[model samples]
Target: MTSSTQAVELQSFLSQITDRDKGLTAACAAIAEIGAAAAEMAELIALGRLYGSIGAATDHKNTDGDVQKQLDLIADEKFIAALRRAPVAVVVSEELNEPLVLNEGAPIVVAIDPLDGSSNIDANVSIGTIFSILPVLPGAGEPTAHFLQPGRVQLAAGFAVYGPQTSLVLAIAGKTQIFTFDRRVGAFIRTSADVQIKEDATEYAINASNYRHWDPSVKIFIDDCVKGADGPFGRNYNMRWIASLVAEAYRILLRGGLFLYPGDHREGYADGRLRLCYEANPMALVAENAGGAATDGHRRILDILPASIHVRSPLIFGSVWLVDLVSRFYADPHFSPERAPLFAQRGLMRG
Candidate 1:
């Protein structure tokens, strides 16, 4: 779709991918509405004229103890209000201490991060929302364990990024797709289909500030990247750290790169920085669907079961080979640091 004219509505596109499951169809409709509302909220945020204050820091913190910006609360309220009209049964939010029970007997449960990258709000950097949809469990009282299911059981996962151009990325039933918001028509339109991450990429994203606090595996990996051509990798690598997961993920999907927020020795950050339910789980699905890999630096991210609603995780994901290398560091203690053959210089045969 062109920037001005409408091509395909998000609902229409979702309908094409989803089949006869009425519950899933209804959930998709709800997600589309949430996306639209979120995009509108983003506009208001960009203009600095929304409920409460746009970028002002609130006295409150979310359930995970992160300080809440004014926009974070507004986005949370707007999303919850929008979902109220949908057929969803249960809702879990990063801002809330507990799950909210909506339409009883409904078939869907949603875990959401209404406003990701709130730290970037004042800087006018890109931020976005993430959601994971799962089937409601039977005979549940509070469904605490239900939300703890491994990411592999997720029915659908996606995120809406508010950057230079607002876009939504989704992975449903193993297929990944991307939709750009056409503000002219006030709808999301298909921009890219079956998006894939390039398997070979040298770029990586991580916070170098935390290098001292990182584990040995994480520390050595970044050391190799910093050394570049003179070090084990034998290839110069680009380093990026936007501190915004959605924006980082978007860039990786387009080109290719590795992103890491592995658990370190720092107190309160031992489990890593990102939340498992809303951040890592959905992201792992999208990365895997795009032919990439995601891990906690020790194991597959989607395989880890959450211990709590706001449990944190060490997320490392991106191009397959880069991710594999990171995982190998944790898998084999004796694995030597060496340059990859792909990046090694070719030379004449030696006697």
Candidate 2:
């Protein structure tokens, strides 16, 4: 456990690391730049309405066709400008139509969601910035190629939550760490060097309004949870839907829970809403590093190769047991409470 007095500033902790590998070093440098930008954004968000219509929708639309909020554009510009000063060779942002080339010769590429959950800006909810850093492919001819690699090749991945107390959750060097932004010191201080997700949790997060559109497998899994103690799972459960990815992820990391954003029958949402390169990939790395798991229903998130930087993917991540159970629901049609009489009779919930 890290005591307050013994807390290490993020830069000092990065500097103290002995592993001098070029990719890791470059990734750390990029993270430092990202952290700086996050701090500025956090301060801006703290001002709320004083910042002037930050949640107001703009005439512009993002790459994914979602209406851009005032704060979203500000965050994209801030992060892009900061990455220009880092060692990043390429940058893929949700706000941009194409990848931005920062430094052709740099060894690392960055993919970012500059301002996630901007829809909650007016509602006084938590929002965040998500980033994934990867080493440039050896012979890649285009900037987009740098981001096409699978999530497993990422050197570092993280997200910053701009909430009551700004926090950064990162996966690097085979460990997941949490840092709190200390305004007094104007730096992030390590709070948890190693964060482990509990193997069992009674909470789950999803948008229940979409239940009718969800696939049968997804519906079956959720049905059992909704049944509570009388269900086949035989355990009471809590449901959460904050409409903020970073906020949900932060809560799961601190405790334990399952979060699912699955593909449904709705138009434009069949692939799910989360972007694979920037959002899902980074969160998956953080979850897996913390001894948790992530999957796109039937496949591991880290193993899937992204076809494009802005491609959307179904995301399910959390405690190992819960995540794996969801996968089982997808793999075996009869593994559900309604279809499998044996499972229903035996009660599939495990400690």
**Per-candidate local distance difference test:** 0.82, 0.90
Per-residue lDDT for 45 in model 1?
Answer: 67
User: Backbone clashes per model, in order?
Assistant: 0, 0
TM-score of every model versus the real structure: 0.92, 0.94
lDDT of 1 by residue, 135-198 (tens): 7777766756668889998888989898888899888857678888887888888787777897
Q: RMSDs, each prediction? A: 3.8, 2.7
Clashing pairs in 2: none
Cα error, residue 58 of model 1, in Å, equals: 1.4
Per-residue accuracy of model 2 over 1-351 as CA lDDT, tens digit each: 212334888997777652555447888888889999999999999999998999999999999899999999999999999999999999999999999999989989999999999989999999999999999999998888989999999999999999999999889988888999999989999988778897668899999999999998899889888988888787889999999999999999987999999999999999899999999999999999999999999889999999998999999999988898888888864585545454445454532
Candidate 1 backbone clash number: 0
Error of 1 at 260 (Å): 0.2
Lowest summed-lDDT stretch of 10 residues in model 2?
Answer: 342-351
Best by the TM-score measure? 2
